[model samples]
Target: MNTSILFQNVKLGPFELKNRIVLPPLTRSRSTQPGNIPNDLMATYYGQRSGAGFMVTEGTQIEPRGQGYAWTPGIYSPEQIAGWKKVTETVHKEGGVIFAQLWHVGRVSHTTLQPGGGAPVAPSAIQAKAVKVFIETGPGQGTLADPSVPRELTTAEVKELVQLYAQAARNALEAGFDGVEIHCANGYLVNQFISAHSNKRTDEYGGSLANRLRFLREIVEAVSAVVGNDRLGVRFAPLFESTTEERVYLGLVEEDPHQTYISAIKILEEVGIAYLSLAEADWENAPDLPEMFRKAVREAFSGRILYAGKYTVEKGVRMVELGYADLIAFGRPFIANPDLPQRIANNWPLNQVDPSSMYGGTEKGYIDYPRYAG
Candidate 1:
């Protein structure tokens, strides 16, 4: 059989990947309650997908205040680190390299998801629209609520958050992760600081593009300082258009996404981080990352590049062959086929993902996926 481009081995910073396929960060909300810690089930879920060249744990909050949904895991406390140790140990035993994605939801959350039922925090005191946050409604079920009006972080508080990101990276190291990926995308905290719609301050951290990028720059610097540039990655979800109703989440598309993200990538390039993970829109018939943007990313950053968002094996191979992306992340496919990379390798049938069980559930759809036997 002629192997696809995704089957090729690649060097990603200090770690070398067995193939060009990656498991991108996904939010399953299966972490233990109260403490929001990773557990054995989560460990098994990740270990089952170890055939991928690399795996990034779901968006793990940097602090309790960082969480925006019920049951989402955190990487802040000692207990959380201990829980993640099991996950990392399992993946390592299978010879897989993994990175922990540190995240904060900013204003895209309800007060119910916040500490003391407090309002969610953001770059500005704006309420996010067209987005819903999952809150605990019962023992095993959750409900989606509209985001609450957020409190704008003062300049001092903003700086404090950067330190939190650094601390999270240190915690990830303690948890045995190979590296850390800064969740600077998806209308989250870092993205809120970058998007003009969410950040309306007149201070140094807002107004111009350079100012909007200040938070992300500071975060990358702080996290890299702890994890080293060779062990850090940044993710950015650049939405090019919002013509459809479904595309209005957090209303985050910049006036000029190409220029905005290109400049952001330039900052990452200057810092010499390990990789840049680009997340495209996942709706059906969504456009691919524009060729111009892809070229700009390749030219701006010297590190490895990863792309995600409803990617298929054929599309992944094509992107690799075109030199646009060094690795491809399959989200839904990985959910149903824990052995996704091996299945692709041997042309095995993939299990269909049950959308109902995607967010929070028991072991039924979480770790029950079968492996290919050829």
Candidate 2:
């Protein structure tokens, strides 16, 4: 047996994961259109990657207005729930633990992707600049478009969104998922509320940092009530350095990211959730998260910690060995190598990911990548 620490079994709340490798949530827009329903193809794709100790499904829209991309899946409708059941059943058959990532794009959306062509909703009326959202122009065709200006959410609507997140957690359990992870990262609905840049609300849900965090606190508490804190995880993209404009659009790259995120994490600690997934800046040549912040995170959060974004096997091993991360989520690497854990354990060569077929496509790049055959 491999003696690498990464290969050792670890406890994540009620579950004992077989290894520390995780398949992070990746948005592959292959869901069946017209309903944005998960399909058999998605099941096959996820089943192939079940060697992961933990898996999180793509950013599934929590409601109709929550979608920002073409062909992504949703968890609100009955048919969508049944469709995800197939995916969960397949992953369970392979002895893999999977979590559904509840998502709402919020202002990172085009009017075309909104319900009834309405403006996307946010904690404040703002447009996410320097970013593009995918929209289907015709069958089998799509193009990137600028995000539409979003309308501010009424205080009641914000509270209703918390209930929607809770309902999505219920749907995830009903669909046979092992747990659910809230997509609070990447300047989505939850992140927008947290960032002062986007959330310019005058209501109780905005202004002060505590007010900004109120939405996340409410959603976490509500969802935890439904799924139990042990079965819930929250993700955040905390970029401390502001090198790129896209990072500004995606994460809002808070002026004091360290303070904003550490404060957010303290709330998770209070709820005692299963795990905290932190996503670093992934763009090429992106600066590594400050060592100071990593140490702070370990000190603040008592639960298991996960880190994703452009991590290599050596880097992941180092993080785990240093006790900064309990799990390492592999995004692109997992996409090209379904048997990623085995390859890492054995030091085997990895398959290269195809950028052309990365998004919405047939099985070519989605599931056709060959496993190591030595």
List model 2 lDDT by residue over 1-374, tens digit each.
Answer: 22388888999989999999999999999999889999999999999999999999999999999999999999999999999999999999999999999999999999999889999999989889778899999997999998999999999999999999999999999999999999999889999999999999999999999999999999999999999999999999887766654544374878898899899999999999999999888888888899999999999999999999899888998899888999999999999999998898888999999999988978999999999999
**Model 2 score (lDDT):** 0.93
The segments of candidate 2 whose C-alpha lies over 4 angstroms from its true place after superposition are 1-3, 248-251
Listed in order, each prediction's TM-score against the native is 0.98, 0.98
Q: Which candidate is the best by lDDT?
A: 2
Error of 2 at 180 (Å): 0.4
Compose the digit string of candidate 1's lDDT tens values, residues 1-374: 34467888899889889998889999999999879989999999999999999999999999878888899999999999999999999999999999999999999888888889898899999988878888899887788888899999999999999999999999999999999999988889999999998899999999999999999999999999999999999999998877564433467888899889999999999899999999888888887778888988898889999999988777877787778889899999999998888888888888898888898989988998777666
Error of 1 at 171 (Å): 0.2
RMSD of each: 1.2, 1.3
